[model samples]
Target: MLSDKSRPIIQATLPAVGAHIEEIAKCFYGLLFAAHPELMDGLFNRSHQADATQQQALAGSVAAFATALVNSPDRLPENLLSRIAHKHTSLGIQPEQYQIVHDHLMSAIAEVLGDAVTPDVAAAWDEVYWLMAYTLTHVERGLYGARGVSPQTVWRQWEVEKKIQETDDVVTFVVKRIEDHLVKPSLPGQYISVQVPLPDGTRQSRQYSLSRADQGDSRQFSVKRVHGAAGKPDGEASTLLHTNVSVGDVLTLSVPFGPLVLDDYSGRSMVFISAGIGITPMAGMLSHLATTGSALPIMLLHADHNENAFALRDQIRDDIVALRHASIYVWYEQGADSKLPVQGVFAGKMDLSHVRLPDNAVYHMCGPVPFMHSIRSALIALGIPPRDIQYEMFGPDLWQADYE
Candidate 1:
C-alpha cells in the first residue's frame, strides 16, 4: 500500500511521468549498461535492447504500476508482479540487482524531468519503485524457495540427446540432465530458460516452453529459426541453437518457472487456443494430461499458415488421441488438410463459429497479441467470462492491459 503522503504526490505527477516514461526508460538503460556492461553478457536480451522493446516494456510497467497504485491504493497488481517475478526468477535475477536498477532508474527520472523532480516528488516516486521492486523480490524469493535453489544455482547443464526437425523452420531438442541430481518435476505449461554462447563469445538466454511432459531426467523444447524481417536483427540465441547445436551438445538451462501452469481441472473441460509456436506450452499440457490418463474433456483449437508450418502436429495428434474425451480443430490461412484426423478443419483465420465450445470451459490461449485480442473478443462475445481466460506471450508483455 502506498503511504497517504506519497499517494497524492504520485497522483499529481503520474501524468507527467507517464508522458516522458519512454525517454526515461531509454536513458536508464543507457546509463545502466554503460556502467555495468557485464549485465549485457547474459542477463539482458541484446536483441530486445537493440529493438527498444525492453525499454518499452520497462516504461509501461512503471507507468502501469504507478497508475494502479493511485487508482487502488489498497491493492497491488498481483498478476503483473507475478508475471515479472516468474520471468526474473527464470533469468536468475538477484535481489541486489534491484538496487542497481533503482539507482539508475531514479537518475534517469531526475535527468529527464529536471526541475520538475522536486525532493518530495522524487521521494514519492522512490516509494513507488521500491514498493514494486520489493513486491517482485518477495514473489521471486518464494519462487526460488519453492524450487529449492538460489539464484546462482538455478541453472543446470543438460546434454542434448536428439534434435528432431519439426518443420523447415522449427526444431525440437530432447535433452537429458547431465548431473546426478534428480530433475525437478515440471508442471504443464511451465518454461525453462536456455542460455547459449553466441559466436561473439557472449552468452544470451531465451525461454522456451516445455514441449513435452516431464520425462524423469529428460525434457523437450522446440525452437523456431528466427529470420529477421523488415530491418530487424535475427534472434541470436535461437539462430545459434538451430545452426550450431547438435546431439551430445551441452546447454545451460534454468529450472522451470512460469505462472501459466495448467491446473488440475479434474472434471472440468480445458480449451487450448494457440497459433504458430504458441502451441509449445499447450503441447506440454496435453502430453501431461495424456500421461496422467486425465478424464477431463480437452479441446485444442489451433491456427497456422499451413500444414507445413504447424510444428508438433503429430505429437499433438497422438496426445489428443490418447485422451478419451479430447478433440482438435485446426485452421489454416492458405488451405486445410482434409485428411488430418481432427474434429473440424477450416480454411482462413480461426473462427469459433464452426466449433462447439464446452460449457463452463476454462480457456488458455497464446499467440501474437493481435491474434489473442481477436480470439478473446470472440470468446467474450460468445459469453465466456474474461476472468476465465488466461494467455501467455512470447516476448515482453507489451499488451498487458489488453490481456487484463
Candidate 2:
C-alpha cells in the first residue's frame, strides 16, 4: 500500500512528465523495437503502430500509473485492467514485452528529465511502473489462459472476399475465412484487426468494428478510410481494404476483442449514441435485441451529416419495430429532408440541453473526437458516471485521449 506522503509527489510530478511524453514515447518505441524486432511480427498491427495512438496509449498509461499511485494507492480497478489486458491480448502482446517497455520508459524519463530526476522522483516512478507492469503481467497471463488460439495466429493471410462501399470514405470488408470456418459466434460490439501485406513488404494492420449483426454469419468489417497523417495515405491496410483488396485477397485477422460489448439484456435498459459510422456496433446490439426478443428499453440517438448517409438508421428501426420501447432520435447536421422512423428529431447538432435520456441509461457512444468529447462532457456534467458510458473508435484506440 502507498503511504500518504507519496501522493503529493506523484501528483506534482505528473504534469512535468506529461509535457515530455512525446519524446519519451519516441525513445521508448525506438528501444523496444531495436531490442525486440520480432514483436512486430506478432504483437503490432503495423498501420495502427504507425498511427500515434499506440505510442500515446503507452505514455498515457505511465502518466495514469502516476495518478493511480497518488490518488488510489490501492489495487488496479477491474475495468481498467480488463481494458489493458484486452489491448495486449488482441495485439498478442506476450509476457516478456512488459519488462522491455518498463526499462526503456524509465531510461527515457531519466534521459529527458535530467536534473529533476531525483532519488525520490525516480523511486516514485519506479513504484508506479512496477505496479502497472505487475497488473498487466498477471492480467495478460490470465487472458491468455482461456483465449483458445485463433486460426490466423500470425499476421500473414486474411482473404478479403468483397469490398462494399458504405460511404465515399467507408467500406465494408467481407472476409471469407482466415484459416478455418467464417461463421463463428462473436460478441456484439467486439472488433477484429485487419493486417494487409503492403506493396513495399512492410505490413499495415487496422481494427475495424464488425458491421454484421449476426455472430453466426460470415465475418464482415465496416472500416473507414483515415487519410493517413504525415504524407501517409489512408493506411496501406485500410486503402487496400477499400480500393484494391477485393474478391479473393487474403489478409490477416486477429480474433474479436473489446470490452465495449453488450450485456445480458435478459433485463436492463440502455441507450446508444453514435455519429456517422459509429452506428455499426449499435446495429449489432439492436440485431441481437431483435433476435432474442429482449424487452429491454433501447433508445438510439444518432447524429449524422444527413439522413441519406445515416448508415443503419432504417434497418435498425425495422429490426425491433415491435418493441415500441425502442426509439431513435436523429439529428441531421445538414438541413436535409428529415423524414421517417425518427422521433425527437432535429436538424442541427445533438441537443444537449433538455435532453432526457432514459432512467438508468448506459450510454454507448462512438464518433469523431470532438463529437464524443462534447457528448461525454455534457453527460458527465449532467451526473453520468464514466462506467455508465461506453464507446469504440472507428480507427485506432482513442482510450489514450479519453484518459488524458
Candidate 2's residue-wise lDDT over 228-272, tens digit each? 677776665666667777678676777777778898553667888
lDDT, candidate 1, 276-386, per-residue tens: 999999999999999999989899999999988999988988898899999999999998774557989999999999998999898899889899989999999999988
Model 2: per-residue Cα lDDT at residue 160: 68
| Weakest lDDT window of 10 consecutive positions for candidate 1 | 72-81
Error of 1 at 178 (Å): 0.8
Candidate 1 regions off by >4 Å?
402-404
Query: Which candidate should be chosen as best, given TM-score against the real structure?
Result: 1
RMSD of 1: 1.1
TM-score per prediction, in order, is 0.98, 0.85
Instruction: State how far residue 251 of model 2 sits from its true place (Å).
Output: 2.7
